[model samples]
Target: MDTAERTLIDPTHFREVMGHYPTGVAVVTGVVDGEPVGMVVGTFSSVSMDPPLVAFMPQVGSRTWDRLTLAPALCVNVLAHDQLELCRTMAVPRPDKFDGVDWVPSTLGAPVLTDAVAHVHCRQQSVVEAGDHWIVLCAVEGMEVTRPATPLLFFQGGYGGFSPAGMAAKADAELITAVRLGDRARPQVERLASRLECEAAALVAISPDELTTAVSAYGGSATMVEPLGQRVPLIPPIGEAYVAGAAPEVVERWLAKVGPNEPGLVECYRSRLAAVAERGVALSMVGPGARSDYQRLHEALAEYASGELTPARERAVRTVLAQTRHFFDELDVLPDETYDVGAVVVPVHGPDGRVAMVLRITQLPAGMPGRVVNGWIEELRTAAGCVERDLVGRGAQQASDYRDWWEADFPM
Candidate 1:
């Protein structure tokens, strides 16, 4: 912690360590000589409330800072997550940084960038010389929160956005509640379970890591038991229906984290995903072998859910799941010999066209004829379509209700 010890830590090491802290991105803009001038700064901070003060640090060598400091007032425009390109435009040295950029003048005549999350208009207050940078302080004269949006974040030498954990938890809860309170789909899934004499379950994507069984109707003879709220890893066979229609980047991220690097396995997964997309459903054979594997997997997952597994065991189970990718391939492809027990999953799309939930039927009896299996598949697809249509209808109704309320409240 001494100066000499600190000096021993190289600049690269210091930067890498400090990069763990996330900061918001903002652009300091002003009007000088009847032209728009701006520069990006990542170190903007609020200093005081009573006096209404704000501060930002600019590198002493920045030519833009030299010109910006001459202006009588400055406007700090906090960038939104969608304004990354604007940040880049003001980052490098350029003669006309405002070229093709949209802006308007604030009360103090400082350029306020359009679509910014907020703007703080301030008058020049003071400056202090900090090592290799100038700490420019300003007195806030006016401010406005232009819009509500996700703030752009800078961390670990990259740009990102924030999603509150509480919001995600609330969203998950709402999705579960929706599944349970469904008038159209929940009853349909129950009827399907009764007709097929198999367990029919609804699975929702709770997070990128796992899917939660929101609701299930047991057919009394289901060999496997997936209770309500049971969470399972977003792995194949169990989660292929959700993954099949997910965004490419999302699928890639999931694979990079948990998928094996073997090319053959990757190719197999690709083919399975392609087939799921083409056929609009996912199928998995649940013979005696698969049932045993699933039973053990379910036990391990339950232990994980209860936080009873040690770190080593958790890792071991994850590895096992990744290595068993081959077991989930071409599940819909019927074998030369008929096998008892299989699962057919159909995805239910939400208002955004993303797969919000899946309807799955498990534990088909052995010696079932091909025609019967095909019939089951068609029936599952029809059920999924019904659920999707119902969800869309509900979403449209809610939107219309909101519009009516807004019109009544505003009377304009």
Candidate 2:
């Protein structure tokens, strides 16, 4: 053999070494020989969601790949944490990988592991050569999640599960050894918690055995706090080791104590909500205790803030508020318990064009010199650069149209 040729590793040996790096496991299932057939793979990944597509790699000379390409439809089943053994069984040289495996035929006649966390059915699209593997692209036509389970993880040539959020997931070797040194690091953790507005940062429990697992695998250390009156686990959500969402005033306070980085602070606030949204956050409500009703109020106001509250949404909000007001109005209280409420449209222009009108609802602080109208006018002037009467007619029409949609969809 030539010297250069001898130095190059064989595909088999290279694959074995690459296996050490670890990857998520998935099962690519399709109809073969008039029956469902499948192979385990770790290279499956999403390609796109618009017009939906998915892709995975199959070894170039794989007979399974050849069979899969002939099928009309395929199912990619993302394995759960306990499916590592199934993946290993399918990886070996075997004629019947599904002989004793638990699976069910999907609607498309593709094998779907009964315990898979999620399964997506797709039509075969195309295949392209990529190094020593054939990249198989498929158009996802149908999908289902039969089970909800944390995923399996492969790393360092072995299988493992993920730990809960926080330091357990990403702490390095130095942090581990430092923990063994004891209470010396407690102050730092407390400082971190105080700064983060979250408790339980100091006594993080992690070990070498814990590092091999995947994300959200193990829970954090058991620690006690006075407010809770009991010992609780402290596992911060992922990436919170750096910073989290805070009010501008809170951020200013943190900077005063710990100093600040201009770029990092900007990125922290920008990325916090953006990342959470990506992770499928449904609802978020922020404000003071009394205004906890802000979410509903905001929705109602947002409808009209553009000067277009559909008559239906506006009417619904108005009806609800009216009912509450009627009940409160009937009840006897000190100083006659007078309440002032109203809405105004103030135009705001930035470097761009007209942005929005600042909407405010103020409960008057009794015995004041000025009437409620004065407060409303002062608020509108400060909230927006320009006050426009045009808002009333334009918003009323839009609100009427919106009311039509709400009436049709939501009968209440």
Candidate 3:
């Protein structure tokens, strides 16, 4: 080291800035002296492929690292998003951390966690002395992705799972456009939510099969908050308003997912879309008897939001949603009839009259009169009209341009 190169860096500032880079979470476990030993590490990474090598940096004075050094081999269990508690248990400094933990011995004689996304069995190959840490290199013996789920991550002193921003059918620039449109609707959404005493949100079709919440506002007793980028499935009965004016092929592809178990439901949903197109707004209600069905719909939507479902799981989720079709039953809105409003949906259109975005209101006061719910629908429609006019002022979202962008990024 050159004397001129010596520089003093503030430890707190260094840690603060470096914390911005997220790292994968893993628990290194090994059996030593007939006892299981484990410690959580956010510094796990592969260092070489030619020699099948990996490395993790442990604090220089870490007692857990010191204890694990005696083991013949160690296994790195990549934690899944749902294993934060498990990670905390392994991270604690204790002698009986593995008690009641489900695990088995790996091929390299190291403890492999049962529900980890992956297990990498390795033996220590080199211990490089680094300032304030030990760069423990390992010769990879075997590795396999076991559970294959979204891995847990550490960022800015907190834990969160990966939400793929690129999971949409549009590119970053187009997504920025969507956000801009959402910004145009933000004020209106907030105002409508306040006036209606409910939740209001702007949703954009990121893909044919999914729509992400671009903006949201809550008022009154509405406590539900939709994350700005939370994606919801576009299956039947869920997003009819978003696609009532869509191209025939787009609507057809959406309807085909209605499932075959109930043959009559195909036309029923088809009529629902037609009604949405005619009324220019979608209306649904949850009666006292149907509240359980409404909760089931919400649960199914939450599962779809995870974006981690396998084909079988996705099919199962779709079935759950399809079975809730009775919740979206047609409403004639008799003025004197009392209704428990479920949601109000209206569309924001492009220049060519294509359905581009949707405004939805949910979590409303139950047991409202049909006339009151009708007034709420009018408010949502007016807000959607304002956003549409604002979008026109920007001269953006021309159907040709939007279609080109969508097709270029993701084939329809």
- Number of the top candidate by lDDT? 3
Cα lDDT tens digits, model 1, 1-412, are 5566655668898899989999999999998888888999999999999999999999999999999888888999999988999999989899778999999899899999999989999988999998779999999999988865667899999998765321222244534543443334677688788888888887765556566777788675865466677666664445778788876754664555545566666676777777887788887665556667766666666754543333445566676666555446545545345645457888877666766678888866766755677778888888888887777786445423332442353231
Q: What is the Cα-based lDDT of residue 109 in candidate 1? A: 94
**Higher-ranked by lDDT: 2 or 3:** 3
Evaluate candidate 2 by giving its C-alpha RMSD to the native, one decimal: 20.7
Candidate 3 differs from the real structure by a C-alpha RMSD in angstroms, to one decimal, of 11.1
Local accuracy by lDDT, each model: 0.74, 0.47, 0.83
- TM per candidate comes to 0.51, 0.42, 0.63
Indicate the residue-level lDDT of 97 in model 2: 79
For model 2, the superposed segments whose C-alpha errors exceed 4 Å read 1-21, 164-231, 235-412
| 1 against 3, candidate with superior TM-score | 3
Would you list the rank order by TM-score, best first? Answer: 3, 1, 2
The digit string of per-residue lDDT tens for model 2 on 1-412 reads 5567667788789878887776888888887787667888888989998979999999999987877788888999988887888888777757677888888788888888888879999987888997779888899988986775557777766777655321123335423332332222233334333432232222121221111111010113322222211111111111121112322332333333222435554454345434532321111212234243433443443432232222344445444332222211111112433332211212222222222111222222323223443443444344232212322333334323332432353232
Compare the candidates by TM-score and give the number of the best one. Answer: 3
Candidate 1 vs. true structure, TM-score? 0.51
Give one digit per residue, the lDDT tens place, for model 3 in 190-264: 998898878999987777777778888998989865677777878887889987988887788788777667668
Give residue 294's lDDT in candidate 1 (0 to 100): 61
